[model samples]
Target: MPLKYLTADQSRAARGLLNWSRVRLAARSNLGEATISDFENGHRIPSPRKLAAMRQAFERAGVVFTAGGPTLSNRSAGEGGVIGTQ
Candidate 1:
């Protein structure tokens, strides 16, 4: 399956669903808070490594991104993904 990237809307929703603030996400992702701010605000697209950091952090917090409906998962699966070399 092709990877499902985090759209800005999804990013915001996911954070809310996880009950996390941007600061928390940044801490978990090991990214600067400003980076997270820019990403969420659509002012920037994170680099692949940074994006992966964000995705993995969210996954660890039990936020799943699925192709179907709004079903959630508790899996700590963080594999087979690449945000590209940007």
Candidate 2:
């Protein structure tokens, strides 16, 4: 099955919840920082592999994405996780 990619908002939220930077996520996912930055900035959509890599990276770090928003596992990740990474 095709994996559901996280929205730009959710991606940003997950990063905040993990207190991670774009470089951090890119390093962890073995993807380029530009890829993550572009996706999160709504400049581009990542391929399945890149999306899966990013999601897996966040998941391993205890982030969970929901219809409502992204949250840290077993903890409340506050709303308005929107940050200006543009």
- Name the candidate that leads on lDDT: 2
Instruction: Tell me how far candidate 1 lies from the true structure as C-alpha RMSD in angstroms.
Output: 6.5
Report clash pairs, candidate 2: none
Candidate 2 lDDT, 9-79, residue by residue in tens: 66777788778899999999999999999998889998888888888787777665554433334445443
Tell me the alpha-carbon RMSD of every candidate. 6.5, 5.9
- Candidate 2, run of 10 with poorest lDDT: 77-86
Error of 2 at 81 (Å): 12
Counted clashes in each candidate structure: 0, 0
Query: lDDT value for candidate 2?
Result: 0.71
Against the true structure, what is each candidate's TM-score?
0.73, 0.74
| Model 1 weakest lDDT span, ten residues long | 77-86
Best by TM-score: 2
Native-referenced Cα lDDT, model 1: 0.69
